[model samples]
Target chain A: MKTKRIRAGAAAMTGVLLLGACGEGGPGGSGGDFTDGKLVLAVMNDQSGVYKDASGPNSVKAVKMAVADYKKKHGDKAVVDDIEVTSTDHQNKPDIANTKAQELYERGGADVILDVPTSSAALAVANQAKTHKKLFLDVSAATMELTGAQCNKYTFQWAYNTYMLANGTGTTVTGNGDKNWHIIYPDYQFGQDMTKSFTEAISKAGGTVQGTIPTPFPNDNFATFLTKAGSTNPDVIGTMQAGGDLINVVKQFNESGLKERGIDLAVGLMLITDIHSLGVDQFAGTMFTDAWYWNMDDESRAWADRFRDETGTRPTFEHAGNYSAALQYLEAVQEAGTDDADKVVAKLEGKKVNDVFLRNGEIRAKDHSVVHDAYLARVKKPSDVKEDWDYEEIVTTIPAAKAFPPAEASACSM
Target chain B: MNAVLQYAVQGLAAGSFYALAALGLAIIFGVLGVVNFAHGAFYMLGAVTAAVLLDTLDLTLWWSLLVVPVLMFAFGVVVERLLVQWLLRLDPLYNFLLTFGLTLVLVELVKQKYGVSGLPYKPPKLLSGRVDLAGVVLPRYQLFVFLFSVAICVLVWLVMTRTRVGMIVRASTEKPDLARALGINVGRWVTPVFGFGVALAGLAGVLAAPFRAITADMGNNFAIILFAVVVIGGLGSIVGAVVAGFMVGLVEAFGQAYAPTYAQILIFVLMALIILVRPAGLFGRKEATA
Candidate 1:
């Protein structure tokens, strides 16, 4: 009888401990009311499509890395030990992104969605985030609309945008005395925004906008457009094409003898993957702007080393941006002591961030634009590259204040 | 005047790709009574094969132009025997469905092996720079592609007209029922004819390797435009395919040059206008079913 009473007492103690573990949402123990006692990070982007090489699967891996680093840094103080990362392919379609974003928020129980690449798809997802009242950190998509006309309380425009790209490349190139410019861009939202931003920057820097050409997105041939751009004899031809289209334009430009005709080429935006696809020699001595380079500094190279070890290729700016965004999101969750969207939004807004991807970064409260220092780099000559994937040589740094448009100029009423 | 001449040359040069791929599509459709929707996939495979050959085997563009077609021909024969032959007697839609499925499989397989960023192929140093044709300078590579594709089309035309085997194949393609009634045995030539047609597509791909982006989806737009070419030329009409291929290329080039916003739309407009005029296509023989 005495032993049976002792056993019942032990069972009561064990039950109480289990109850405490389940109900712990205060201070230290699994802090905050987490859904299912865990955090779910959803990464949506183009996985098997044209933009795959730029971000795709690598972005997912970067998030996992961020989770690991966060756990390591926070150790036992980590808000939630069971952080889960899930991913789906949006295929760069806005409708698909809308459907998938709804499913992820409603059914999949994702707390936050990250790394949406295409601007149209990203906008669709931003709408879903607002409707669902879920946190979203956009890493790859570059349209300024996210922070301009389309800004919301739940969405944060994380990486570089069309405004930042144009502000850096346009001002730098025009300031270098290539006063007359002709721009060719894809006839889409992102391209239209880029053209507008570039024209503004060019005229501001005393450069004349000679012509503007709008071509189809994902077009393989640029010979016709290049010919038209060259006929007017602009001092520099600014190409606002990206991914496979950009490669075609560059290749055709060389083949068409445009460089020989004394017309300089200025890329509106470029990534390391592009340089890697078409060797450094194709873009030798060409000046362009980049948000982040893997080999930028020792801190970045250290992170990049870990990234390359996980993924076969070096991380692009999108990949690094994802890592930074994820880590920062988790940090905000921890700071707010909960994964609640409103609380996390308060935590992230106006927060200064310095990381491998974002140099002197600051998340603006009014517009939610993550302003950061952008690099103006020249594609190193083939002979200058000492190791693999060493493509860019940083020439100048566009400071964070000058990299993006002022918050007061934003069209976003939010 | 120089700009106009340049645009003309550019249009013709762009047309060469459509002309070559459409010619194969026309021949295959002519002989097999199959739409062969995978013609675009075959073109993609051709360019990919050339790029891979150069990347892996250290082969040059010259060798690729010579070798890729032969390889594609062999691949075409195997596909015809293993998958396509089984559906030959069924409704033509079945064959179309089968080839469409084949295109998906081949595209995914390629994407699995080589990621979507695309591969690089530099033209031979001999053909890399520009060629001055009087005052209208053209890229030597573009000029070479135009000339090379024309030579190939002529050779194909000769084979279709001059030889006894060519005559038999032509008879089977143009009037299969009549040829079969005459005891020509149209079944025997189907395999080689299909192989020959795929080879032409592969040839076009090889020529395009140095000129266009060598990606898995490179053939997607090319294929769509090729359908417009075949339709504009009249389905299964060899001369029509070639003529319309160059015609569409010129239209697209000029459209892109002058009406930048309506470049793609212009191709369809031209297709619509031609269809309105010639319901049977410029070179196609109107069939009872059609």
Candidate 2:
């Protein structure tokens, strides 16, 4: 009798469950998941190649921190459900980054992609995101073509580009009367773009490019390159290289004994992380353009400390940019109330943001290039370095409007 | 004229590294009949080991150079015994694939320990700064590298051609059947020969650390060039490897001077042209290769 009663009860419960299941094909099953009211971000970057340390897997950590901070600050307003971060190492290849970006959008369900370093890879990811109509926030790639020929509605380079760098460092050095330039550039698209940008900037500042040398990327030695630079007897030896290549180039440049001969060095782009690696003594009095510096102010230091605690290393500009881009993206999604591509993009466009990430940051509606002040920084002398991470001393701030190329000059139709 | 001199010096210096690496490749190919594709990885390992020694033990360059090669030599012996020896009787292509895979494993291992951005190795103070070569300026350390590497090469050559060890190695390599028949167990020398070959690669790595970007991937570009040097030198000929190393270097140096962009392509192009002219290479004996 007891068994029969239990069987009857189970049948009744099954009928109720079937009725509840049959009523479930309602508004929630729209298939427009939109990260399920989540801000899903995908980070694609060079994880195991030359650009690994400059911006790699640590970028993923930076994005996650942005998510955490967004939740803590805004509570349920940041994401309707939660923020999710997914990442992959692009290995400094464009095709790989593109495939990964596609996977992130189609399968991983990511709303934004951030922290791609190498120019080629970053450009590829930017284009891919545009085709998919998903947001791409480039953190560390330094190419001008992204904002020029390749600028899209969805792609926004969060960090520095070759043009801005060329403007800040190239113009300043040329303005100092160090004419007759000998430019040594890594023979790649980014390097080529930099060479063109620097030439234009130097001409504007009343300087002549005496000669240009194209060097192999990821060169083993720069002693020969430096010797050739010295051979030309130019007033300035401008190096259009960065990362490990930059480190080798700068080290050999300093040791080439050319400084005593009235030849100055002009680095197109530099980071505090680079200074820390190459030793501040080697770069003392060396002026360069930087997108951001960690110890820029009281607020930045507090944030950097938290970043250091998370990454176990001082936050590079790339790391800081990743955090900023991620946070801004979350805020844009929140403002839009949904992860719809058109709506979220509209919210981000023409938005003037003043957050821990951006000082007077304006996401220009025309081309989606974030315009912000870039710093003119000098490498602190050995005696001036107060701590291990203390490397750069801000000389002056180049306003966003001045630092970035105008729409007419950039010719970005989007 | 000054630029020519600079290119020549630079080319010759680069050639010296190629020759150092090719010497080991030639030895292993001669004794073991395998290409030892891991030679470049071994070279990189030598550099990584030296950098680690300096970072952890605060060891000086000279001492690390001494210690690194021996450690690498022993390491080569163990690898030969445990892994390489198992595939000795197989086809040469199999061994090539094995070593190629080994190179990736070794490179990845190093990358895991030290992040891929590369670590800096400071050159000794004695070798810092540029040396005024009367009218032209050359780096003091580079000049030292040219001289030091040549000396080590000579020492290696002397040991191969002059010493009792050389005699045994020659006999075992020249007539393995006769060597075994004459109460000389040729098997006993295989480990040492493999060890010696990889040791040379390790030594080249030590010599390179101060000059090149000491990273996990540093060996990759050079490894391709090293193979070309070996082929141009005539498969297993030590003297050929030495001669070709300098020749390729000179070609590269002069190429860089004239054609900076196409210099790397110029190397492989030269290799293809040389093969068309001499199938067994410039110094290779036709019958031996056949």
Candidate 3:
């Protein structure tokens, strides 16, 4: 009888767990009514895998900081109350990320979802946001598809896209006498998109593509690819790997002493988070572009100082984007005077948002793309830096018009 | 010729890690007949322990290489005595399930504690740069890992073959009933042997810390691959495990180099082909018919 009781207890516990896992929002979960009349935000990103090093917990912290700042500025009538934030580990898988977003929105009472780091995963969540009629402010996930062919009315792409990074870096480097390009890219959609954009941009700037090599995603051994790249003997070798794969590739490339062989390393999209993982010594002399840098301007520096004080690390591009998106989203809701998704989205569609990171950045109604300055940065030398977290030196700032892809090219019906 | 030599060196460097991990898996299976799903977790623990020690005590890689495995060995002993000992009398499948569950628990605990953001571990200053090896430059750290792994494997072989303790271990696996009849406390040795196998895994983790990103789920992929290595090597054969580990590493490295897209698929294909030819593994002994 005692054994039977124990078996029954185990079965009951399993039932409870399964129900909890499968249930829609219980009280106080995401997408529930904000009883306290405060906007709750859900910051979802790959808390693990390739994007984690740069975009995970720090991004959540950035959004929180933005909420705190917004609350301070609009103290009386614009009080942001009961603001809660939660995160999920997407592990770079689209299916897992999509499920997590659904859970966040359906059960967590999130008014706005921010900082999804993968492109495919971002697209999944964007689709879900439209179905749910919720606001999705994409802080990362650079595929133009989120604001282009796969664009949804409820979604906004706030940070750098593949087109911006590709055009900014590729055109500049190839035009400046580094005309012959060799490419080593990950064999995925993101990699293919980057390579395609880069090649077109380079050729458009009167450069030639010597060769291209696509490696498997999450590939560890890069010696073979590096050796093959060395043989091609291009003016510059454009790397399209991200996260730990990027670190491994750069480290191995350095180890092979290939830099001495006259092949320059050019990164397609190197974030502040990647630089932090790699350190200054590993990335010195490497050039890349980003939407925001912690030390770029007084506003960014001041905001980063506040963020670092709270989070104990420098804010990454995804983190900065989260702050930008959250601030804009809350402002739109305030302007719309209601939390109705369509009303708030309409308010945000053609509005110009000024935040600590972006100056006079406008939300394009054409595809919900945020138009802002894109920074062309080079990794600062060890001797050039005076303190920790001081890495990039901003080379040039591309204007909003030149930085964004043309609406015709974007192919975003929304 | 230079490119081939370069790829070969790269393959050997990577193979060293696979070989060390496979050796641990083989040892556990040979003596205890447990698949040891937590071996990779133990490996991750080894790296994490080293990182924590570096933070707390400012320990260098030299000291971590010494201290981390010892601590993990004690942890292994505790786990075996408390958890694994209960499942010994049951079917091997029960042990597999128990250990697999333990792996999930350990990984989750680590993720909770470390927060899933990969912690970076820099190589010691001495091992930071590359060395010119026959005109091909190789990282000094990779070279060290290769040599260190081989030395440990040799040391393990020596202890297993040249000592009386080794004889007893072999006898226990071969005929546990007879070994117990001969007045050997076979039950007592099980825990320590398991602990030792776990320590070997921990050592592999310590060696891998600088080379790879130290994350909570680092062990999951590696552990699965380690099983494939053991299977290809002929499960429960130490020498076979080491050989097959290097073989898989080489195949994977070269396959990724030449084919690019089909690199991971090639590994599974190789394992399938090997199993077709040798169902019991390359070094596995045929079972005696009743």
Please tell me what DockQ candidate 1 reaches: 0.68
lDDT of 3 by residue, A1-414 (tens): 446435534553464466654322223222323322446688888774556657787788777777787788787867345566677777767898788777665555566788888788888989888766788888788888888888998899998789889988998888778898989999888898899989989999999888888887776667777877777678888999987678768767766667876778899988776676556777898888778888888888888888889888888877788888888787777777666678888898878767776656889999988988888889999899988889999999988888888766778896
Candidate 2 overall lDDT versus native: 0.80
lDDT of 1 by residue, B64-163 (tens): 9889999999999999999899999999999999999999999889988998888877678999889888777789999898888888888888888898
TM-score (second chain) of model 2: 0.96
lDDT of 2 by residue, B245-273 (tens): 88888887776677776667777888898
| Winning candidate number (DockQ) | 1
Q: Rank the candidates by TM-score, best first.
A: 1, 2, 3
Q: DockQ ranking from best to worst?
A: 1, 2, 3
Q: Pick the candidate with the highest TM-score.
A: 1
Best lDDT among the predictions, by candidate number: 1
Model 3 compared with the native: what TM-score? 0.88
- Interface Cα RMSD in Å, per prediction: 1.1, 2.2, 2.7
Quality class of the docking in candidate 3, CAPRI style: acceptable
Give lDDT: candidate 3, residue A86. 70
User: Candidate 1: what's its TM-score on chain B?
Assistant: 0.97
Return the TM-score for each candidate structure: 0.95, 0.92, 0.88
Off by over 4 Å in 1: A1-32
Q: Name the runs in model 2 displaced over 4 angstroms.
A: A1-35
